[model samples]
Target: MSGTVTLGMVPVVLTALFFVLADGQITNDFLIAHLLAMGVPVIGPAAIWYWDARVFPTFVDQSADLAANPTAVQRVGDKYKAIFSTRSWYFVVPWIALIVGLTVLNLGFFETVGITGAGDPAFWVYLLFAAWWGLITGIGLHGAVTAVRAIRAVGELDLQIDPLHPDGLGGLSMIGHLAIWTTMLISLGSLALPLAFLLGTEGGYRAVVYLAVGVYIVVIAVSFVYPTVYVNRRAGEIQERELEKRREKIRQLQTQAANLEEADGDTGTIDEVATRLEIQRLRDEFNEYDSVSLYPLSVGIIIRLVSSLFLPIFFTLIDIYLGQLL
Candidate 1:
């Protein structure tokens, strides 16, 4: 995290000089307009790469704990490593970035993108960042789809659910941790967007910023949901299946206790008392399984996601209100 999250800000400092000097458009609030905008791209790729490198490995490592068949689970782990490792998508994502950057350029924000603009040395920086940012977004799009499919594929493993696990999640509580951290990191990157809009020159980038964010919201929201959907389904299946078995066990115990009592006098045999105790234990297990949480989301993770998703917009609204008051 320090490697990715801390090192992620390096580009912010590197680009500060360029934005300050760019096109003679130097200003005191460079941090607000340009650094914030620049951070979106910088922090973004760093977070995405961090998720690809770090979180997934920790999740895949849990395969052994997930089941006794670590070797079979490791094959699924291999597929995960392969999905993230492939570079074939590298060639395609850039093309999409170029197309998007060109379209954003055509929106008339950067002097309509021509030779006249190229005469200014700073023009290329803006143009380059445009394509670079798009490249990051494209990679995000690809990562979102593949990550969801990768998570959904976990159901293919011959994994067993431990109904009596401590976490009450049938030994699968760790699966959704992948989504929680990555989405929060990317959402932190989004904290910059509104400042970029508020301080941007002459409201030129407003429409473009709004359009970019609308699309980003969809993609990020999907990223937020990917890790838990299949795991939640699997949890529900285990809860139902295990509860049925407990019911059957209880029925057998009840019948045995009945027979022992009929064979005994007014005072029952110890066997009858033991059978009743066994039936009560099975009933407790049934209630636990029946009341297992449907969604794998813990309150803490849900709160983290909500705050990450809403905090930027909340701050932006406050800033807007303050501006109106002033």
Candidate 2:
């Protein structure tokens, strides 16, 4: 985090120096917001990689029993390992181009919207901020792509129901928590957007900022939810598959129970009765497993995710509203 703050400070210091040297003033709000928005996106990928360090190993161990074959875990690990390679580093290059390209286009659009501040901003300000956003966004996209793909690779493994899991989420709550952590960082970054208002954008400029932020909010939410949705489908499939198997067994048990009257003697009748009782016992146990959860998340964790998405945005809005009122 401190390292990110340091990277964040580079733009702040340089932009400030440029504005002060050429124009004699800099907006404190833009300075703060500009630093914050870029910083948190960088932090998002770091948090993901940190969580992956732990989540990957634990997920591998927890899902061992559910894999289609003994080698399934190893196969998935190789796929995951591929992500750490230079081949994967290539992933960020295109993101940099896209983000920086958009930044350049927005600069042109903002020019038409009119610069409300001292003349037009120095070209240095444009170059520095755009490069910073491009770099941060590229790094963030790298992490987002890696995290989602790793989870999907795991999701492709055969899901066997594990009702007896201590977490009650089939040991998959870590995944839910991982996504929650990601979205929380994104939300925190969004809080910085409202502060950009302090930079003094007006008319079309304000509308564009709001539109971009709104679209970004939607994108972040989708990024956060996609993995959960993927894993959840796998969970439901496993539950239904396991339940159907037990239903087949129950049908067979019922057929065997119907034949009790054909037993050879009292001893045979006793044995037949015992077999029916045992099947009934087995059926009852699997029925419990069938009732287990079909999601890797708990109700409380879901609430946390919801809060992470809306609370910061709401708080920032209220702060802006009240500030305007005052």
TM-score of each: 0.76, 0.76
Which ranges in model 2 have alpha carbons more than 4 Å from their true place? Answer: 1-22, 38-48, 84-91, 98-126, 195-200, 315-319, 322-326
CA error at residue 49 for candidate 1, angstroms: 4.7
Q: 135-218 in candidate 1: lDDT tens per residue?
A: 555565555555666666665565567667776666666665666775665565465565445534333556766676666666
- Worst 10 contiguous positions by lDDT, candidate 1: 107-116
**What lDDT is reached at residue 191 by model 1?**
56
lDDT of 2 at 315: 46
- Model 1 C-alpha lDDT versus the unseen true structure: 0.62
Clashing pairs in 2: none
